[model samples]
Target: MIRFGVIGTNWITEQFIQAALESEEFALSAVYSRTEERAKDFAAKYDIPNLYTDLESMAASDQVDAVYIASPNSFHAKQTIVFLNHGKHVLCEKPIASNAAETKAMIAASQMNNVLLMEALKSTLMPNFRAVVDNLHKIGTVRRYFASYCQYSSRYDAFKQGNILNAFNPAYSNGSLMDLGIYCLYPLVTLFGKPNSVQAAGVLLSSGVDGEGSMVMSYKDMDAVIQHSKISNSYLPAEIQGENGTIVIDKINQPGSVRIHYKDGSVEDITVPQVKPSMHYEVKEFIELMKSGRVESTVNSHANSLAAMEVIDETRRQIGLVFAADLK
Candidate 1:
């Protein structure tokens, strides 16, 4: 069985551990945390066989065949390099790095070590995501796209009071774009490839972080409007309008179903039942890849991660959203 270790025992880590337990092909063996209490609690709660206080020790241990990193965006690059240098396959959480340059270095480390490295872009591995991509031709001659991910931050009240949590801290190499906009950017790049141009605008919090933003990606014949927020909720569905029909995704980040609205007034309703929660899709996909001796999933390949980063980096550039940590 493929043994897994994870860095950062946060909410997302717990969710992923549960999904790993549900899959018979893999085991959650080890975990790491910056705090002793959190690390021990997470290990016991999940019944993980081992826990480490230091990432270097975890990388050296034979306790895991691969490592899942759910650390903050700022730590993704360094933590990924540690696992890759140790000859362990790595499944890191998204924004693969703080920027394109960091991403490039991480990719080079994986290549030099001759190990598999992939971003945990769970949305790109789902049935509903594929449902939309598979019907691309049927939808025909796309004209416009709209995608948004907005949820009131659990720490927004603190943020407003001049108290900054890790999620809201720009020092953590995170913001709405890294956390939410990636959902839209992933599909946009995967389904549409690179765009001809990108223009963006956003409201920066007092902390100099993006509280919410809207970006327009211009293509030759089609345009995609993307939105992400950390302070409010979005009421609109993410959909694309083509010359022939419109494809609607209920939740672009975690889609449960899809539907097609034809120009002729006919509708096609597609159902994608959630199995082991929506996060199960990528967990299972990773297990299968390890078992089959495959390095990457064709659906969410290395190229896909690179492409998504390309859009994210450029979009940030246009908005002048520079992070100091990104400067080497």
Candidate 2:
């Protein structure tokens, strides 16, 4: 069995760990936190025997075959390299690195160690996404792709008052685009390769961070306009339009359902109903990859991660969104 360990204790991490316990291919062996007290609490709650504050110590542990890095974005590059150097596979959260250069370094480390490494983009694996792809015939030749994920953040008010939290801080390497926009970008990259050229513009708050933003990735004959905002709510569904029909994904970020409308005036509901949260797909997929001892899966490959990161990196550059700690 592939023994898996986690390094974060967020809600997403909890859901993933529970799924691992139920999965036959993976075993949950360890967890890590920044402090002994936090680690102790999480370890007792989850029944994880091993816990540590140091990343290197966790990487050197034999109990884990793979490490799942769900820490902040800035730490992804360094921790991934550390895990690879210690001969453990890594599965990281989206936005692989702070920039393309750092992303390349992580890729090199994983490849040199002959270990599996991937970005955990659950949007592409959810059944809702498959339903959208499976019924694309009705849409004919795709002409446009639009995705918008916007939610009024409870922390935004705090951010406005200058009380910075990791979720709203540029220092932590987060914002609407990095957090929500990636969901839209991953599916677009999966459905359509890299764009011909990308134009990104966003409303930068006083803290020198993105409050809300929209990006346009242009193609020769088509376009994908993506929006991720922490300022307001949007009624727009992530959608596709063609010569004959259109498809609407209720929520692209966590697409619960999808529907298609053909030119002949017929509406088809392709929504997939599942009891588990949308994150279950990503957890199960990671387990499958570890069990097969595969460096990558056909559904989500290192090349795909590289391509997606390239888009984000260019977008950050276009918007002048450089982090304070980005080492040259």
Candidate 3:
């Protein structure tokens, strides 16, 4: 079994741990939090033996052969580099790092250490996502791709009450685009590669972060539009328009249901049933790469992560969204 260490005690981290354990290829050996109490509390639920309050100690520990990092956006690069330098494989949660430059450094560290480093982008690895890609030829001559993921943040109420959480805080290197819009961008880049140019606009909160945003990525013969927000909800399904038909994706992030609407008034349901606890796919892939002695995933390759981050950097620039990490 591949021994795993987890950083962060948030809901997403909990989901990842559940998924990793469910895969049965991994054993949860360590948990790390900034505070001992928090680490103890988190580890208690999983019966995890090793609790660490220091990242360096956890990095140097023999308890873990790999780490799953779900820390805040700003901490992803530094934390991942520490683990990489210590020769631990890392499966970092996405938007790989705060910006393209940080992502490059993280990839460099992985290369220098010859350890497995994969971005935990669950969407791109889902069976249903592969189904979409495999069936792309049914819809010939693609012209436009539109995707939107806008769920009003549960923490928005707290923010409105004068509590600025990490979701809306620039110091954490987070906002609507980095948090939600990436769902759209990653898939787009995975399917079509990087676009030629990007045009973006967004609503920035007083905390110096975007609340909602839209980006239009221009390609040679097609344009992809993505809308993301943390202040509103959208029930619209994402669609890829082509001359012959349109591919409709139910959830841009999870892609539970995918269909095609053809011009001849015929419809096809093409979704491959996803594995339960969607994060499981990423964990399985991570372990497979580690066992195969590969340092990067062919699906979530370094080039793909860097391309996506470059798009995010351009989008932030267009919207005038700057994070303290960018200044540093």
In candidate 2, stretches whose alpha carbon ends up further than 4 angstroms from where it belongs are: none
**Where does model 3 exceed 4 Å of error?**
none
Q: What value does the lDDT take at residue 200 in candidate 1?
A: 88
Predicted structure with the largest TM-score when compared to the true one: 3
Go through the candidates in order and give each one's C-alpha lDDT: 0.84, 0.83, 0.94
Tens-digit per-residue lDDT, 93-185, candidate 3:
987899999999999999999999999999999888999999999999999999999999998889999999999999999999999999999
| All candidates in order of TM-score, best leading | 3, 1, 2
Which whole-number lDDT from 0 to 100 does residue 177 have in model 2?
Answer: 80
The window of 10 residues in a row where model 1 has the poorest summed lDDT is 270-279
Q: Against the true structure, what is each candidate's TM-score? A: 0.96, 0.95, 0.98
Candidate 1: residue pairs that collide: none
How many residue pairs clash per model? 0, 0, 0
Error of 2 at 294 (Å): 1.6
Query: Could you give me the TM-score of model 2 versus the true structure?
Result: 0.95
